[model samples]
Target: MTEQLSTTFNSLREAWLQHRPDERQRREDLLRLRSAFKASLPQMTEAISRDFGHRSAHESMLAEAMIVLKEIDHCLHKLKKWMKPQRRKAGWQFWPAKAEIRFVPLGVVGILSPWNYPVNLSLTPLISAIAAGNHVFLKPSEHTPHTNAYLTRLLHDCFPQNRVSIIQGGADIAAAFSSLPFDHLFFTGSTAVGKKVMAAAAKNLTPVTLELGGKSPALIAPDADLTKTVSRILTGKLFNAGQTCIAPDYVLLPENQLETFIAECQSQTAQRYNEANGQTDYTAIINESQYKRLTGLADDASIRGHKVIPLLSLNDTQKAENRHILPPMLVINPDDDSAIMQEEIFGPLLPVKTYRSYDEALRYIITRDRPLAFYIFSSSNEPVENALSNVVAGSVCINDTLYQFACANLPFGGVGMSGMGHYHGEEGFKTFSKVMPVLRKYNPAATDYLRPPYGRFADTLIRFLTK
Candidate 1:
């Protein structure tokens, strides 16, 4: 394994040293990868489902494969234009000198992908690195063993391992990966683990794009359309069983409308998944640990006078083992110190907090460190604009959540506690690239001033230009 990894980096360094691929060659490579991904979507989806026990294929397509395909297509179409060296205006003293920024690939990149959206998060950034003309080393999360195995096989089949390889294992392997002094590192997981990754990368001073998850909140003002509000919030919350980094972790609503909003949300759940226990379309939590964590939050909240409403009517008597089938839950007016609010809730629990006014809601959302994503469910354009402008987050959706990430033109990432850097779209290429600015003075006409030995006119010109 060590030999394989060393050879991969050596080959990528060799590639960068020997030749810089032209725009056509870069595009051809991206298109080939894109086509390969399109052909393998079904197999990838099946593997993901197998790994998770019951991940929905439609969810996989919508949340992972389709988004990845869009990103690939977007990059392929725009890379040539993005690759063009940007000319910059120079000062009067440097009239003959031209300055430009060139987006150059940073050799071999290391990507440590989480299991939630293994295919999309793992392969999408790989596409960006490829588009940026860098070889990649992808380490898909080992928790999803089946998916990781398939990813390794398919990537080795489609692309040369030395160019793009998938390394697999648990924490030790992940730690080993973070130790490698790659040109850049891209990681997606919890903020706690993200900090560890950052620390590990610090040893090599490797720049990283940490796509960490946070407790993203969605606010609904008094005048908002409850129907549209509940529908969108539920989709974001329940998508991947609320495993998404940008999923609505909880909600803030006007106190008077709390009951109305909950009723509508419950109704929406029924319409989508119905009341059946095991037949619910939305999948289970990733594993027993996650399920226990979520249930513990619910149990803890219920004990603290917070109302717990499991959207589906599932009896506690239903055959329960380590299967971890906790249904989507709604916590009403949970205490500020509740466990759900203590950290990023990456499960099927959505806590609903009631606020009196827009300022109160805004304060609640902003009081925490800037989140990965913020959401507002309001028809009033003023409030939406105010929220978007005032609050700092990786991304925002005015009347919805999570869908903003689906747009390949948009940059997806977090700020502060949520995360540091961004990826996706043209930003993805920029994230994996080192945009070094180059300046050249080719005109001999300008050499007279530079070659002077303290002549009065030359000194005067230099002083004037410096001033």
Candidate 2:
């Protein structure tokens, strides 16, 4: 496996070096990928659904298919302009010389994507690398074997193996893949694993962009509308069963309104999901291991005397394990030191914490490790502005959640322990590109006057320039 990985990488790298893709070829590649992706939507949806036990087709279309299609369209529309050399002003002393930066492909890019949102995560970065005109090698999550199979076929049909290749395997293969000497490495997964990926990439001095997960918090101000806040929070939190990296891991709101928020959450969950009828609209936990982890989080909180409020009926709780579908639940005021509060809870369990003052809430978020995303729900502009100005996060969405990631124009990434680097939109293009600066001289040399030793003209020019 190691030999095969190295040989494949060498072949792609050699091909890229021998004949780098031109603007036209890059555009054609993106167009081909877009067409192939659209043609396989139905099969892709089924594969993803099968991987997750019962992933919703609607959610799959809305989140995965729609998002990737929009990204492809975005790249196609902006590729030409992004490829053009950007003009930069030259210094007055070097007036005859012209300066510009050219956006060129970085030989080869390797993408290591996670199981959650497999299609979107894998393809979005792939689209960006293609837009920047780089050959790519991708490693999808092992947990989503069915989806990975579909992706392999779709990508292979779109391009030759040298242009784009999808490799599938478990941890051993992943380790070997990460250790390869690629021009750039992109990883989307947990912070713990992100560290390992970075360490591996460091041995080769390979630059990496890690899109890691952390405990993202949603801050609800006193003036915020409880109904709207609860609805938006649940929508983002429950989407993909709260398996999203930027999903609201917890909520911090006014102390007096905790019960009201809980009640509103119950109402919203009942309205949105129809678990009683066994409808497949609600997504299940990805696997038995994930299911057990989520259940264990809630159980630990419950044993510690935290009020675990189930939005669904008692009957649904009995059959939840069999289906691996843990309904949405609120863990009221779990201790700050508890497991749920300490780790990134990638599940349907939302820990609601109360804050006496708005500053207190801000302090709570500010003191923790910088998160991938920070959400502020406020009716008035003061608290929103305050939070925006004071809090530090990779991205921020006012009065809502998850839509920050949906914006094709914004850069999505993390900070501190969350992760590093950005992607999506022009940032994504830049992430996979080598923005090389070039200086072209058109006429007589500007520095010729200063080249002589102990010359009076040189002294005058130096003084004038310094002054």
Candidate 3:
């Protein structure tokens, strides 16, 4: 397996070295990929659903299909402009030199995508690499074989094997894939795995863009509307059963508004997800292990005497028979040291913490490891500005959640322990590109007189240039 991986990478590297795609070729490739992806939407949706045990069709369309399509469109529309060399000012010392920066392809790019939102995560980065005129080697999550199979077929049909290839396997293959020498490696998963990927890539001195998850917080100001704030929080949190990287891992609001927030959460959840009527609007946990881990977090909190409120009622038997669907719930102020609070909650369990003052809330967020996303719900500008100024995060959505990632123009990434690097829109293009600066020198250069050995003319020219 390792030998085969090496052989495939070598072939791709050689092929890319021989002939990189030009602007017209890249646009044509993107257009073909977009067409194939659009045509396969129905099958793609079904494959993702099968992989997740019971993924919502609408959610798959909105989060995966629609978002990827929009990204491709954004790239297609902006590729020409992005490809144009950017003119830069040359210093007086090099008076007759013209300078510009060219966006060039960086050989083969390796992509490691996660199972959560598998299609979107894989294809979005692939699109960026293609737009940047690089060959791609992708490895989708092993947990989603169905989706991976579909992706392999779709991508291969649109692009040649040397241009775009998808490899499928478990942890061993992922480790091996990360160790492969590529121009750049892009990974989307947990922070722990991200560290390992970075370390592996370090052996080759390869650059990496890690889109990792952390404990993102949603803060509600004292003057914010509880109804709207709770609704948006639940919407973002419960999307994909809180498996999103930027999902609201916890909530911090005023102490007096705790009860009101809880009430609003329950009301909004009931209205949005009508399980009693047999509407499968909600998504199930990805698999048995994930389901166990989520339940374990809640159990640990409950055993410690923290208030565990279930927004939707479901018995153990029902939860098991329904493919491990853990309903949305709140863990009110679990101890800061508890498992649920310490780790990223990639499930529907939201830990709600209260703050005595707005400053306290900002402090709580600022002190922790910078998160992937920070959501602030406030009507007044003062508290919003305070939070914005103090709390450092990968991205911020003032009154909403997850919308920041949907915007192609915005650069999406994390800080400190959360993760590093940005990818989306122009940032994505640049991330996958090598921005090379070029200086074209004319015959009548200003530095000709200053290049000689110790002489009066050289000294005078140097002095004048320095002055």
Candidate 4:
């Protein structure tokens, strides 16, 4: 085991040193990876579906495969500008000298990806690292064995193992992987595990970027259209059965519009997922354990006097035999201390809380740890601006959820308890890179007057510059 780990690390270091890629080479390699991804779209979809038991192929294509395709395009298009050295003005003390910022590649960046959206989460960072000219060592989650296996084979066809390698294993391997001294570490998982990863990386002094989950909230304003907002909210929450890290954890709606909001949400969910016996489009919980945990949360809330309503009642067969296919549920005004409210519900279960005013809604969110993402579905800008300014979330989307992560131009990450740092597009490149400030001197005699003596001319020059 020690030999295996050391071998992988040493190979990455040697590969990184053997060939430091320039902008043209980086773009060409990205294009090659891009073509490979597009060609294997069908296989990639099937692999993720097998991992999740029953993930929608359409969802997989859009969220996992195609998103990476677009990201590759974005990188290739912006590579020259991103790689260009940024010139800085020389100060009065160093007049006539040139100063610039150069983005240097960090060797052997370690990537720790999660099961949810494994393809995108794993390769998107890889894309950024490759663009920044770093050799990558990725460790995908063990839960998605099928997808990870496919990823291993697919990446093998594109590049040599020494350049960008994928390591697969369970928790023990993961613990050991985190402790390795990589140039940088990028992790995506739950907040509890994120803390541990951060601690482990600290021992190596490895700079880290953690993309973690929390109880992200969706707030509705008075002037918003329930028709459009409710439909979008349903899509966001039900997508991947709410397995998304940035999915709306809870809804804060107007007190007077509670019943109408609930009715509209249920209606939209049924419309989008119109299946009687079982939901073919609806994603299942990853496994039996996840299903039980989600059910436990719903059951605890139900027992504690919270109104638990299934968007669509599943047959006994679907509920009993097909337990992994968890039905969408709405919890009306769950108690603040309940598990549904306290814990991050990473399934198709959403709690709808009512507030009298915007202040009340904002207060409820502020009292908790800063979330990964926050949303407001308002036509007006005042409430959106207020929430964006007051809230300290990692990212905010006014009138939307989860789409911010799709944009390669935007930096996707968390703040506070949600997690730390960001990695997407240029930010991802910057995260995996060491930016060094370079100073060039054209004339040696430019500093001769102030070098040794601190004489009259030096004093006069200092006074002149200061004045």
Candidate 5:
């Protein structure tokens, strides 16, 4: 597998060296990329659902298929503007010289995408790279074989093997792919794997954008509407069974409103899905392994005396283990040292922590490694504004969740250990682009007096400029 990936990488690099795509060719390629996905929407949806072991078709379409389509449309409309060089003002010291900032295409870009939201993660970066006029080599997660096959075929139909391609394989291939020293490496996964990817890329001084997972917290501010707030939190947490990186990992509740929020959460979660089983719009864990891992998290929390409550009454349904469907759960006041509190709970287990004051909540969040996302639900903008001022995050959704990614105008990334760099909106274009500053000296004698030669005039000019 590693050998095959190496050979494919060589081929892609050679292709990039041979065919440097201009703006027009890139536009044509992007149009083809969007068209191919449009033609295969149904197939793409089905492929992802199958790989997820009963993933909701609506969720697949909304999160993966629909998001990719929107991203492509965004790139297509803005590519021309994004490609144009912007005139920058030359300082008075360099007066009579013209300056501009040009966005140059990096060579071959290598992307390592994740299984969750497979289509969106795989193609969003690809669109940005292509729009920036670079070739791409993508490797989708091995867990999503069905989706990978679809991507391999769909992308091939739109592009030649070298211009844009997919390499389908397991971890060995992934490790090999990361070490190849591509011009840029874009990765979306857990922080552990992100560290490994960055380390490998460091060998070649390859720049990387890691969209890694962290325990994102949603704060329920004072005067928040309990019903509306709970509904929004459930929408973010239960979507994709909480496999999203930006999904609210836990909820920080105002102590006075804890009971009201709990009641509302129970009601909202019940109304969101027909059954906790695999029969409704609710999704299953990707496989038996993930199912076990999530259950273990809950069980460990329970044994440690934390209150782990199932949001639904699953008494009448088949065992969740049998269907690999882990129901949504709420953990009340977990121990600070608990695994559920310390780790990125990527499942539906949302631990609720109470705060007596907003200062306490803000301080708690600040004490940890910066998260990929933060949610503030407040009736008034003042509290939200205050929290926003005090907190730092990769992205923030005010009075809601997961809507931050919907805007193609904003940059999405993490700070500190959550991850580094960004890849969405205009930031995505810049991530794959090399911003080169070009200065042309049309007037030759602009700095003649400042040049070497110790003269009274030179000294006077230097003193004047220095002053």
Candidate 6:
């Protein structure tokens, strides 16, 4: 096994050395990969549903298929321009010399994908890496083994393994994979895991783009329209059963309007889903562990005197044995020390906290490191602008959440504990390439400021310009 692993690594290194694939080849491969990916969508949905036990097919299409296809198209539309060598202005000292920036591809990239967004999270980065003219090694989440296997096979059928490979295993294999010194690394996971991945990449001084998650908050000011607020909040939470990195971790509401927000949210939740048994419009959690973890947060809050309401009420007996299923839960008066509040609630539980005023809510969010994404739901433009201007999250949404990630033109990633660096859009190309600045010498007579005679005139000229 070690011999094969070493051989594979050596092969990739050789491929990277030999890779001078032209623009035409890159486009052809991308188009072929696109067709293969599109063909697998139906099966991908099935594997995701089997992995989560009740993943909504429609939700999968909206979240995964729509976004991935749009990204593919976005890259294809702009790839030619993005691949062109950009002309840069030469300084006055090099008046006759030409300067330009070329977008050279990184040799090989190792992408560690998260389970929450198994398809788009994994494949979208691949698109960027490929578009940037580099080969890739994708490591999808082991938690979704079926999806992982299917992705591997899909790529294998579409392209040669030497150009793109999929490595599958549990944590041990992932640890081993991370230790390898790839040209660049793109990781999408929790903050804790992101730290480890960053440290591993540091061993080889490999540049990385970490897309970690934080407790992203959504604020609803007093002047906000309640109907719109409820609809947007519920839509954000219901998507992927709230297992999204940018999903609103919690909501801040006006003090007296807390009950009204909860009631409206409850109504909005039911309107999105059918009340029939096991026939939910929303998707399910990834596994029992996630389900239990989500329920534990609710149970902890409920035991601590906070009011917990399942927006879609259910029978007690059926609910106990259920896996991968949880009605939208809203926790009222959740304290700071509660587990749900402390951790990134990557589940369907929404904690409601009442702020004394708009400034109070703003203060709470500013105290923490900026989140990957922050959202504000208000009819008036002032509060929305206030939140966007004040908070330092990676991306801000007005009266919505998680939609920024869908726009192929927008750069997606995080800041601080949420993550470091970004990928997506043109930034994706920059992330995978090293921007080297070059300057050429012009006519000797014109560049005589540094003739090195150790004279006062030369020193004065150098000091005048450089200083």
Q: After superposition, how far is residue 3 of candidate 3 from its true place, in Å?
A: 0.8
Off by over 4 Å in 6: 1-3, 276-278, 315-322, 445-449, 456-460, 463-467
Angstrom error at residue 190, model 6? 0.4
For residues 158-274, write the lDDT of model 4, one tens digit per residue: 888888898889888888888988999999999888888989999989999999999999999888888888888888899999999999999999989988988897788877776
Clashing pairs in 3: none
Stretch of 10 with least lDDT, candidate 3: 314-323
Model 1 RMSD in angstroms:
2.3
Candidate 1: Cα lDDT at 453: 69
Kindly indicate the candidate among 5 and 6 with the higher lDDT: 5
Let me know the TM-score candidate 5 reaches against the reference structure: 0.96
The numbered model that scores best in lDDT is 3
lDDT value, candidate 5, whole model:
0.87
Cα RMSD for candidates in order: 2.3, 1.6, 1.3, 1.6, 1.8, 2.1
- Model 3 clash number: 0
Question: Candidate 3 lDDT, tens digit per residue, 1-467?
Answer: 89888988988888898889998889999999999999999999899989888889999999998899999999999998999999999887787889999999899999999999999999999999999999999999999999999999998899988888888999999999999999999999999999999999999999999999899999999999888898899989999989999999999999999998899988888888776655477888899999999999999999999999999866455566576789888999889999999899999999999999888888899889999999999999998898888988999999999999999999999887889999999999999999999999998865665564669887787688688
TM-score attained by model 6: 0.95
Q: Write the per-residue lDDT of candidate 2 for residues 241-314, one digit (tens) a residue.
A: 89999999999999999889988998878877765656556788899999998899999998899999998653
lDDT of 4: 0.88
Better of 3 and 4 by lDDT: 3
TM-score of candidate 4 relative to the true fold: 0.96
Candidate 4's C-alpha runs over 4 A off are 276-278, 316-321, 444-446
Using Cα atoms with residue i matched to residue i, what is each candidate's TM-score against the true structure?
0.94, 0.97, 0.98, 0.96, 0.96, 0.95
Candidate 1 per-residue lDDT, tens place, 1-467, comes to 66666676677667666765567767877777777778888888888888777787889988888888888889988998889999997666677788999999888899999988888889888888989988788988887988887778777776665577777878987887887889999999999999999999999999988888788889887889988889999989888888888899989888998888889988888878754544436666777777788888999999998889989765444225327656788998889899988988888899999888889889888888888888887777888888887788888888888888988888888888888888888999998888999988766655665574667777877788678
